[model samples]
Target: MSGRLSGKRIIITGAIGNIGKEAVRSFVAEGARVVIGDIDEHAGRAVVAEFGGATHFVKVDVSSEASVASLLAQGVEWLNGLDVLAQNAGLQRSGPITGFSQTDWDALFAVNARAHFFGAKHAVAHLKRSGTGSIINMSSLAGKRGGPGLVAYSASKGAVVAFTTALAMELAPDNIRVNAICPGWVDTAFNQPAIDFMGGANVQQQKIAALVPLGRQARAAEIAPLFVYLASDESAYVTAQSFGIDGGVYNG
Candidate 1:
């Protein structure tokens, strides 16, 4: 509403999901033109329809470098430029380290960690041209403080934080800012993996109530504002930081 991101062009990977959808809405509301990239064409198009003319959709498989490259290319072409890239595509698998399969670990890293690298690698040139670019990678509080049955997921997200920090310093000279958002206990189906691992929805809620200082989980909308701020020029001086949007779940 404040048009904080007026005239900005943004690309959000995994834009069909809970947090991604909210980020798209928030970005569009703030006057940014956005490209919604996801693996699901049906959902991606629906998101574009919901946002009307301010958005476009691109089908992308973030695990593949070629797909990631194509998404950025198509997105930059649609917006005629690029200002922000939000790497929100990720997957979670929760289980004890003793029985965790190599397949699961590799899959988690492919999306949760490697995708961010792919996105950043392809987005740099266009972002440099924009002169005021920002990259927002979605990490998790588990990435900061590992949890039970979350070994693989935590490792992947932690990789995102490390990559974001290093990339920020590498690109700072180009005026490109890179940062990571580490959220905790967001109440969305996206947490179904961890929820099931904990037992069920009831158990997940109980744990959230006990663990988080705020005694609850965050809504996707509650997490979207940070995306808006990081994407806007308001965060021009902010880079190489991992911001925790958790309900006081992480003290570090």
Candidate 2:
């Protein structure tokens, strides 16, 4: 396919999620062997069916240390090696500082923040072996700014950004680059419920074109190529950076 990610073995967490599922398709089309890890058995199996044997599915909670460990072990086993790791699995629950439960706060940290670390930890050895590897973490603009209803999710994402930068330095000597993407509101199923909760009946939908100064919400396909770029040799010198694929929302 003359794709950037050709011949790479990729692992994507939350592979059943809207953006994640699209990523599995794109990465594979671009010549990567992908392993899907998600807690949703049915959804994971459905995705596996769509691609037949091209993908392997792992049932991972990603928040627990043991689950994270197991997922990585299995992911590497399935793919034979890890050339790229996309830590896109996460959960978002709406909450203000006060109404947020200990449960929700902890959950957010475990999935949205901790999973990235575990994924990176597991891939480090293989990445070093290849003499170069890339770690692409999925973040949100909410991490860079304040969002009243998503305190926990925002904080966890901010942690991801910091982690990505620090990791870039850790792996740079190995010729590996680490980066995160700060996507603006994207039209994905997981995020749609939040829009509905925010009193946006076609609200987030209509605002898509106006959300950013460039005038549009990012679609999954639009955001994916960047992931491929960062994970491939195309971004060899780019590391410790968080890119905003916001259509210009971050400009504000």
Candidate 3:
């Protein structure tokens, strides 16, 4: 909280959710002024009110290029510039591969994969000019390992990882760092829908104990510090990296 990200300007998409809210708070606590880009106007405004001076809210439908562009323009205006873009807006559609509808697949990619592209496309110019920009894409452990009925969701998250790596190389010359965080079974309301899709609360608990060596899902606060590390100059040399913050699940 003592100026790790002092004087930085950051934009965080999907800032109303369990994980995203924490990212917004963490960024603010570390001395960064943040623009929260989210579709939930109510929640966004609430966040702005709670954080006061250093935070602003802008409505963003990440699946739309126009919306993403508008968010960037408005955010830059509020912050006076940009330094970090955290692309955390995403959608999860779960179903067996054989039963996955084309509509669901398209929706998943539009929000999860295409949104990252839209964010980076609009933000790169400002970031490149800022000189030490960081782009943090929110992926999931499901991206690295397939889940039984999460084909579309997994595929979309996997695209985030691949996109992050490719964009890192492309942005290296501009000194903008790109990285992806693949979180595993975070204990947040954002994951309740996925848990229900998998089975239910009882089944999810069993899966956590059996599958995760840490024997529990992570809290939103637990996963947030990583965002601070990646966004701060502390990770100046880290780029093109896919970090797995999964309670030992990726290995165990």
Best by TM-score: 1
Tell me the number of clashing residue pairs for each predicted model.
0, 0, 0
Each model's C-alpha lDDT? Answer: 0.94, 0.83, 0.92
238 Cα displacement, candidate 3 (Å): 0.2
**TM-score: model 3 vs. ground truth:** 0.98
Q: Per-residue CA lDDT of candidate 3, range 139-212, in tens?
A: 99988998888888899999999999999999999999999999998887777667887689899999999999
Candidate 1, residue 58: the lDDT equals 93
RMSD of each: 0.7, 1.7, 1.0
Question: Which of the two candidates, 1 or 2, achieves a greater lDDT against the reference?
Answer: 1
- Tens-place lDDT per residue, model 1, 22-48, is 999999999999999999999899999
Per-candidate TM-scores read: 0.99, 0.93, 0.98
- Which clashing pairs does model 3 show? none
Off by over 4 Å in 3: none
Misplaced by over 4 Å in model 2 are 205-211
